[model samples]
Target: MRLVPTPEQRELRDAVRSFLAAASPMPAVRRAMESEPGHDPEVYRRLTGELGLTGLTVPEERGGTGAGHAELAVVLEETGAALLPGPFLATTLAAILLTETGEKEILAGVAAGTTTATVVLDGNRALNGAEADVVLTIDGDRVLARTDGERRPLRTLDPTRRQALVEPGGEVAAVSAAGIARARDLFAVAVAAEQLGVLRASLEAIVAYSRIRVAFNRVIGSYQAVKHRLADMHCTLEQAESIVRYAAWAADEAPAELPGAAALAQAYLGRACFEVASGSLLLHGGIGFTWEHDAHLYYKRAKADEVLLGPPRVHRARLADLLEL
Candidate 1:
């Protein structure tokens, strides 16, 4: 039997999907990408306020609904499919890791939708670095928060999501090696979930388009080659999705499996999602390459997200090492 999401998880996924379809359609995503802070404040507020999503994973004491990482994974998947911008992933990671550090005040603010934060767990930059109220980073075996710094935006492949270089500042929190590893694992799972959404969305878009796109008086989807490629993409998406679910579940119920599951998902889903996005564009013919089309956006996001949690090879190597290869 295949592992599947529970009925409640399905409901949450559908709600987020419906909300994004209306609030962050292609035009809205394009506008948000061009605007400063790279997200719609109104939509972000609605996500946290009306949906109470900001508090989805945070405990009740911290003003959150006290849900688990699985619920957050559902939201992340929808955001990925919608290409919802801003610091959603960053803020979620911060809440999870900071909670482990006993940062209750900050977690409370996060769940309340009043404060947004991000962590530069690796490298010199942070995802969603430019628009966070608080930025956490690693400095010489310690986790520090910036008292003062500036974000230098980078022109990445995906405009829907923003990336920036952040300089470190005063030490705000001290986290152990274990905490750092834990945070990184959780972050990887979130990234994997988003990529999973992209994969699924790409297949759906291509499938729908193929059915209606006529070529030489024949629907493009009726062609055998097109059918085979789409079939392969569907297989990849389904397998990668299973891995992503396992990773999310591991984060909540089985800590021993988290590292392996996260790495496997990251390694496999990165390239798989990229292929699906690229394939969707190719299968759509010339129209897919145009800027006015959303295919390019998905392609760009696929490439960017592929490298976000470390590239495919990076995770592949990690997986091997984790397996004692």
Candidate 2:
């Protein structure tokens, strides 16, 4: 498998990074977290209408660009790094389910960014469910769609993304168990890629702080304790990057291998990201623990993401099951 991103992918990454750098900086993230919709509609519009990212993994006939998971992974990495707060991730996750179940009408709206959605996996709670135009619930051997749902907001570790308890009250449809499982694996890879972004951002923040912050007449980065921790975080970042990339590639190229790849990615990345983000917070000293600092936000995001689909331990158990050991 190729370990490097192709030139086109690199360009895509750069474009997304640049757009986020300008539109969704840390201050913007803070604002978005407090906004009623929980995100910037202008930014979402630009991402979907201008950049056409929501359509990255969707098929051409489905009103998408027909790109594969590799490309989607790149965009998600940028979004994660920026700590983008919205239904973008939720919408994308919904897209995966729609694609798997062949839900053409809603999928087209999702691809065009006109319709937002979230999947209810935990019976009642769903990520970004409050603002979603479409709510999909998996009922035994079927996927149900509801335009109107009894949605009540729920408190969450990450306020950047809203969660709600939904009672879907609309149409019923059929979906295969195999399709659901495949969609789940693809979902794992997508979230892993995003966690990888949080990991990278946390490391960069601490490293930058270490250079400027002085302690005992020297930069903290010069100390062995700080340097060692930074090194460990870097190593963790590298491993998470590899696993996420391989899993994303598997989604596009090797369907049979995707299940295992997806499991490994989440198993490693979930914990690795939380550790690095927590480290970033700790290393920033008293300032990091404060609400005003951006470190806490990243830390919260890492923790939230770790449990969003399930924790690392859960994925580890899944990995063991996949290996039949």
Candidate 3:
């Protein structure tokens, strides 16, 4: 597939890149990671309010930018490149699900950057835990959940996006159960797209490092072993990109192939991202292990995101089911 983004999409991408370059540079990212919350809320507000990124997929009727998943994918790709740390993926995914199901009240705060919400698709059996004002749960074919805030500490590798254990017991809005399954599948695909960005950034960092780091009077990149490793990374990165693009396009244009495509993208990209990030770190040698280096940050995030929505094994199984294998 050509995957040619529209002019508007290109503009959005460039704008986001420029904004991050100035506001959330690598130094800022490192500073936030070491801070108490591990993120700067002010930076997030600027992203939503100034850049209008928080409302990318929101409906115009509900005070959103009214963009779609394709646009969101572009934003996420940039976020990954910048190694943005926050509740962006969680909040965006939650907002998308809520808006799609006619939950308009939630939009006002989310779009305004007042409400910070994240989907709890991590270790818990439930949809999301105490942090959410609303929980969307899938039971068989029925989608049911209530509003309540129950919080618990989670051991997380990526402090950029905090995790919570939420259990809400209150009035719940019920949607068509079938739709819940579809929404979960779509969210999985969106996550895979984001992971592709991380993978790409990691690969680029490795290549840049190899070209500069010298060993025995020659750049390490000139070594056949290093060259071969980079070759494999490129192959995996391209493959991951192919599936992510296909999944995003399928979500927006080809709904019939969505479920299968989403599963394929998630399974492949999740594993491939881990490999790429890990390789990037290894290729950087000891510096990658240090706190000052940016390589470990990407490695941590890649591992975190791989299990964010679901594990690779789970998605692989879903792909098999979708294909009737």
Cα lDDT tens digits for candidate 2, 26-138:
99989988988899999998898898888788899989999999999999988999999999998999989988888799999999989998898676889889889999988
Considering summed lDDT, which 10 consecutive residues are worst modelled in model 2?
A: 167-176
Q: What value of lDDT does candidate 1 attain over all alpha carbons? A: 0.86
Question: Clash number for every model?
Answer: 0, 0, 4
RMSD of each: 1.6, 1.0, 2.3
How do the candidates rank by TM-score, highest first?
Answer: 2, 1, 3
User: How displaced is residue 65 in candidate 2, in Å?
Assistant: 0.7
Candidate No. with top TM-score: 2
The sequence of per-residue lDDT tens digits that candidate 1 reaches over residues 106-185 is 77888888888888755867778888888877675576777357888777778887878888777657778777787788
Give candidate 2 misplaced runs (Cα > 4 Å). Answer: none
Model 3 Cα lDDT, one tens digit per residue, 160-259: 5566666533323466655676688778877887898899999999999998999899999999999999999999988887787788888788888888
Give me the runs in candidate 3 sitting further than 4 Å from their true place. Answer: 123-148
lDDT of each: 0.86, 0.90, 0.77
Q: Which pairs clash inside model 1? A: none
